[model samples]
Target: MGSLTRLIVFLSIFAAITLKSNSEYLLPITKHEPTNQFYTTFNIGSSTKSPVNLLLDLGTNLTWLNCRKLKSLSSLRLVTCQSSTCKSIPGNGCEGKSCLYKQQNPLGQNPVVTGRVVQDRASISTTDGGKFLSQVSVPRFTFSCAGEKTLEGLPPPVAGVLALSPGSSSFTKQVTSAFNVIPKFSLCLPSSGTGRFYIAGIHYFIPPFNDSSSSIPMTLTPIRGTDSGDYLILVQSIYVGGTPLKLNPDLLNGGAKLSTVVHYVLQTDIYNALAQSFTLKAKAMGISKVPSVAPFKHCFDARTVEKNLTGPNVPVIEIGLPGRIGELKWGFYGANTVVKVKETVMCLAFIDGGKKPENLMVIGTHQLQDHMLEFDFSGTVLAFSESLLLHNTSCSTWTSQK
Candidate 1:
């Protein structure tokens, strides 16, 4: 090969490597307090950059939006049913020549909506591992467009659901394929204000948490394989105030799944066990019990609970999971354990999923707030930082640093 040709090939390869190494995307997450739903905003369109807010849903497969409300985009193209993209999508169907997709609304009300698959330009912020760099266009980003009825049960302004499941048509898979980046994403859902959703990036945190110049310490656990496409992990035990709950071994057999949908939902038996244990612990702590609230069975007087930097000084709830060495525990402090419903009233944040529930335990957004969760699809493992509040930091801290 000629010298100039060799030099050009080397430069091309070098540029590709540099781009992949620093190609991280950031999406700011906002918490809707009233609905307890979390959503993120990004620009979608070609000629016009229209900002669309979407709920961050780990259960749904294909990302869908109320596209009828969106103005016509010059770059929008329909995916034909015979295309390879349509074939790869789970539960895909055909409507004439267009690729038809039916997506279950995450809100559960007005259950499912069928739409045609479409691709358009979407804009997102790119980062250089640690800092926000510039706006980048994701050309031909594939998503489905739903009608107005699908918007029911969804918080207003939240145009649609951003599917982050393990399915082929998930937002994570599409982004990974488009950028040739790591097949992983991290979420730091905030209790209030804004947090961050990072796509294929090195996890970075502000000091005290990272003064040693390392990623925040995370407990690694295997992601159990399932046809459901939900992120499931094994929970060996549950503890209140460091004391293990006397749960039937079979109760933990189903495994616990992580969700962005609802607050912690435990099976009837499991909920009874946990609530009973927590009540006893609270009694010992001299925390006064109040009348139970609607969704929550255990209510307490917020005035009686001591205040701490981390949150209300309540007994820590720990979830024990299988780790590389011995078992690892993810603990939830007062910030994540209890929610204040009214003045002087706070209740345990767990909800009863009733008998014969689909999953034994579904860890919800309430317990996940202020904590960093890395979902590594390539590794089939989840790396988690228990609570940022414990480190005098929060999910918002990551965005503020940028």
Candidate 2:
């Protein structure tokens, strides 16, 4: 009886340790309204916890921070030029003995910034699949230390950029290596208030989303690899209110890239087609059009548009992608389709990226808000929940829960 009791206790202790080690990490995402950018904050220090707010960039390779604001530098360690860590980092250089890393500012304000590849203790909250469990310390967290000048165009409080791209020195890669967990991260961008960023493990949400029988379905599409490490996915066709727009096949040959930096940018021709189709549909619904906004061509009088719990009652935009069985369509409802730039004005949230742009279409952060996007690097797939608002919940709903 004594031996059996000891075995049970030992198993229990082992299970606890395993659970803690494999637990997912959570970061709260805050939307900077003026810039339409999203950022996540975490602590980086050994003796003390100093909060660092970083812009979430899906295309950036290396995570670079303004070390000038870092309070505790006692635990900081610089990578040597000869070390394997330095060799693993792309665009690495040697500045004396310390390894140098060159990172681009996602905002395009500072094209290139050189920094030292460094490691330090960073802390983040871990969850027990659904709720917050405890805070865990990640030792030797890899990141680069950039100068103050590199923070141009970033939010006043933001000190750095968190790279979520598929790079050797990306935040996702380092976290996966440190925790020995799956190489996946889920981003829930909120239209307002706060959202949640889950790293590794299963993604859990509240009532409707968590319910197995009645939960909203997710569309899984392939994530095409790019030389620049940007997340690109093939968008076969686009429809505005169930009517497909006539687009040149060549226009979509390059595929559409997901960006957290700018607003949705479509090739001039594609934009015109989408705008015209949407305008016709809006007119049919008795929606009045207003003068075009700077970036958005389709602005409408907010008073004329009806409002629902989801958002402004506007035409749904569907992005069609290749699915295993057939074509999968990710629908964007009013909440994700239109943005209120003013009290009386709302606009179709898309920008015209002139002719010959790098990627034919770039889906931006404004359209991504209130949607759940899971980037699974191991599977090379992107599983997306079209719009959380459709399920009578927003990304903010997830963060508000305990």
Candidate 3:
């Protein structure tokens, strides 16, 4: 079958599976009280009730918990060299017959510190009608306990990391193995309101796509390489309204043989290029008196417009893909790309990655708001759809498809 046919068939087959209780298992994903990192809170340990707050990281494997206080807990046991789980973890020091993990900085800083691995009971609460209700607990949840120090890039109140990326140690894989659900999940980040994270299957906001007209279809692009934790996809072209930006496709790839990742942090050069192109187009489209905002390179005066104006009338940004799949278009008010920074100004939300890698071009959470992003690791493709926030009341009644 063709790719489209194959996707429909796969979704149909997976959707048919009767969940033990409910077709979908839910989790309460919070911003960790409004920080850059999104988090999912869970309780760890067996009778001791050690609460662990883990950062929901799509860029790393190995769910980790800070064990500084609970290092002596009876539930926390070091994985021996003879165990299969120990072999799945990367790193050395196995001669001691204990699983050791060393934190490596992406910027090539020296190894920060190493931690001992352990498996303990972890439980997360579920939501009903948008309110957190009860808990679904899991025993023998594989994670590492911070040994010498707390996990890097996280501070107190934030205890450990929740791995959502592919691999044996990731939470997604472990959850899938334990539950036998489809090895996939969906996330819908809203521009203004609280967003949601679905562990496995659809959020019930998007109606099951039966035909083309009822729902929009997006192209599924494969992520490149094995070791990288990024969700990389192929970008065919980018257009502002009807005008295509004059960007060298190779520049998006950072002159490396590696694939392009839809990054949360937009690299400096790429952002500069996009901002320049957008400014040129906006100026030509009668935004002659553009205002410069601090941070965001592109901004518009909000004085002359309505006080509660949704946003600027920026032209639609279209992202194209290879084959007959389909294009993703960001409308003036739909995609939530335009933001009101101050009472008198509205600016674009694309942030600068500064010195970050050019190949790390990502679809940040800001851009992902008001959209449903589905990752099918079993199929090795990323599927995206416009969220029902613009139409439906809530995702409560939408079909929870695989």
Candidate 4:
């Protein structure tokens, strides 16, 4: 063989090998968000009632309570846990349980830390969209660590793990249900790597999805943690949007998909929700039944998804924490919802208020490669008025003495 020919062949082989390796590291999952959403955290039992100033997961399902820790609660204050507004006393940690806790996690499992309304800090994302809008929450809550139970060493200092039947644990039910809908997964919350908060968009705002949406049925599977026992969601797929991604069975062999959806489940609550941005497509999907513990026994669909969302261009600005990391810079958005792109419903996200996430947004999982992301801490079901039974709230001043 000629030298030049041989050299060309050798280089071609080398390039092929390199590209293959890179592909494994960053496989492309569709960019659109397919399902509703998920959270991360579990339960917070009777542990130290002291206020913890750590980050929290908005979708947490921790069991909550109003304790005697806050001695200064005024009668006029209608509280379920502790504080009224989170922005005012973002780091006070005095609130034990309040209405905010109940409003978010409908399951009533979230240990009521002092919940409060966040002061709005509007930031512009799109100027032409008219009024650029976006802001961070103020007066976040502080959980009490005193009088809390300590089981697994891995439990968030404030959110202690809770154990019991699925009916008893909020996370257990949600995680299991989510697992049944999708394939199982090993959640990756690499803080040391990403150095940012978790990303959850669709899960928080309950971004409007398919009109016929229904919860995936699943059961809780118990596992041991560094501290004590925790639950994991045994689902069918771990998808970016609609495609089912394989799970690290080794990591979750015995673990559960802690009640919260994967996004908001975090050690602390950052400025973002618990979801990623992407465009999903389902083609030639199938379904099989698995054990009761296994979420679903089938693969329902294999289709593609690439669509956007619009409502008379209401032009409402939505706020979100970072979604995915690219080039080492964190990104934020005012409104990160769905956008129709070439007949597909993809997750539309904004880029630091630069690119409108709603502009027929479409993303691919390969874009999320080599990045660190986390979700919420616990799976606290918020008690919305419409869904009151799942959750109940009364912000009005009540006389529930500690």
Candidate 5:
């Protein structure tokens, strides 16, 4: 109740948070190589008319377009609750309620598609990278194919329904399902400056790039779940100055937080919190109470890497925890980095367009040769120590407290 009493309470809480009972370490190395790039194109029937340079996203199998952003199709119709020609995707007859064009909701009642031809309104969705939000133009425009060939076992578009069920009977469900059917794929965006692939690889002769510049292109790890957990970038662990590392709350991948969780990267890592806001206010769904980092800013390095550290055969990223676990490279102190308890994970930082980059994490042979996998289980609490546990060599690569 008093000032001194309040200070004591605060200290007690802080102690509870900082205390470490036990810690774990994940494999510190990873492997990577070249792979193919995946792309998708939509054409009317069997014509050479590729409209949208749509990226093939098994995560979004349903082929669609920015309904209003189309180049004026010959005949396109917008389905409505009240339209004589409106019809369900056939067979999906209404139980009691009904409509002429009953294709079910593609984006659901609050469908991801909503834009009036007359009023150009777009929907906002945080992109997969968690870097920024995108306002997708919408007017619900799917090309009116006169006669389009459907996927092998699929049917063609009839009235309003296109056999383009995106794979599954349900429209939106297909996207995620397709991606799941094939977990990993690669695309070459040499222009975008990203190169690294697990299975599919990439097509770009893209100059090897890194998170910012200090390192080379780090593969985009994907984590799977439902819509809410869909667009996650599941990185095994990050790096700093050639060492496995952790990102502080202030410099968290999701640019710290905003008013609410614009996306999961913005999702707070209570276990990984470094600095608390003075206001002590809880953040919104996709937001953090901490300060924000520069937008779209990445790390950079102008100096050449040490040859020994960048040598081949050395596992840069090791898999599994310590002990007799599935480790990639041999275990050695000062040789292969033995993640210490409460150590800091290096980040991908870049200075102004002026000099050599400092403090960057390079994805060496370990990340390249080995696989960036995801278990049905892993601790959600990521911290300096959590980074260690992630490289646990058979769960025994950890500091046990008894």
Candidate 6:
């Protein structure tokens, strides 16, 4: 049998050996207090375990946790430079007798988080309500330990991060490798209801999403280069009210060049183009007195827009992918797209991604509030479907024109 088949057979036996009687486990995720950052609680260590809140990041790879005052620090098994796991992880080297790992931000915009690599016993709630599932113990898992110092951009109280990227050091790769299962997972974040993060075998699916008829299918474009880790999708053209904007041809190419990175920040050039096109069309349709808001160049009068959140006269923004795959549309009524910044001022949430060559276009997470995105690593595809729950308070109560 092939290696993948052999591994699957091995996991079937291991599951019985471990007495973990379940085909899947769900990690309940919640929004960070006062912020949109998504986080989940993890209980790590051995005898004296402690719970820590970690940010769920798709852009990052390695999972790092604060180990400054971890009560079970003594129980961690430090990986040496000679180990195979150390070699698999990039930027790993021997410091005296310790195996140290480093992930430096190519851009100086963010601080570098670095530390030694070690394995420990960790636990996580496997239910939607954060109920502890005794069978799911992450034994002998490798991760980074961020001592007392604070990491750049990481806010207070949020201990560290749980990276869900496809990179070598990512948590998903480690988990699947340890259990000998196919490396695949899915995330479903609703606008108001509970969200679920899943790590399962080849045919990974949440309860309701198992039906094939309930999902919209699309191909995932692999991002080339050693630096590309997050799920990046291809774009054929972008249109504002059916009118195509002149975008760089290289960005829309079929082969593995950079398409947009799916994240929370949008590159300046792309955002500027969309905002300019949308704003110009709005003014021409009888919306009077156009004014610019700092940070967000495209904004309208809050008082006038309050009466009509439908963004009447404003065109629907559509991003088209080749092969008639599908178009991602943004109507004016969604959560963060059109937000009220002040009592009298409301602005578009899209912001400039500063001057950076690699600051390529990114699809903000807020845009996926009412959408279900599936990242199928085994098939190399990204599937998307509109959420079943349509009546979101932050969004327009009227039926969407999807």
Best by lDDT: 1
Error of 3 at 235 (Å): 0.7
Per-model TM-score versus the true fold: 0.95, 0.93, 0.75, 0.21, 0.29, 0.77
RMSD of 2: 2.8
lDDT on C-alpha atoms for all candidate structures: 0.86, 0.84, 0.58, 0.24, 0.24, 0.58
Off by over 4 Å in 4: 1-69, 72-229, 240-242, 246-252, 259-402
The 10-residue segment of model 1 with minimum total lDDT is 203-212
lDDT of 2 at 217: 64
Q: Which parts of model 1 have CA positions greater than 4 angstroms off? A: 1-4, 129-131, 207-214, 398-402
**Model 6 regions lying over 4 Å from their true place:** 1-22, 105-110, 127-135, 190-194, 201-228, 251-264, 284-290, 306-314, 323-333, 354-356, 387-402
Query: lDDT score of model 5?
Result: 0.24
lDDT of 1 by residue, 172-206 (tens): 78887788888889998987888888999675544
Quote the positional error of residue 397 for candidate 2 in Å.
Answer: 1.2
Which segments of model 2 are wrong by more than 4 Å? Answer: 1-22, 210-216, 398-402
Give lDDT tens digits, candidate 6, residues 253-372.
532122111234455667778777877765666544346667666677655542333332345566665333455432323343555566676666676776453546666556555454
Give lDDT: candidate 2, residue 179: 82
Model 4 sits at a Cα RMSD from the real structure of 25.1
Clashing residue pairs in candidate 6 (N, C-alpha, C atoms within 3 angstroms)? none
Tens-digit lDDT track of model 2 for 316-399: 899899999899998887877788888888998888889988788998887888888889988999999867776778887753
Worst 10 contiguous positions by lDDT, candidate 6: 393-402
lDDT of 4 by residue, 5-29 (tens): 9999999998876543221001001
> If the candidates were sorted by their TM-score against the true structure, best first, what order would they fall in?
1, 2, 6, 3, 5, 4
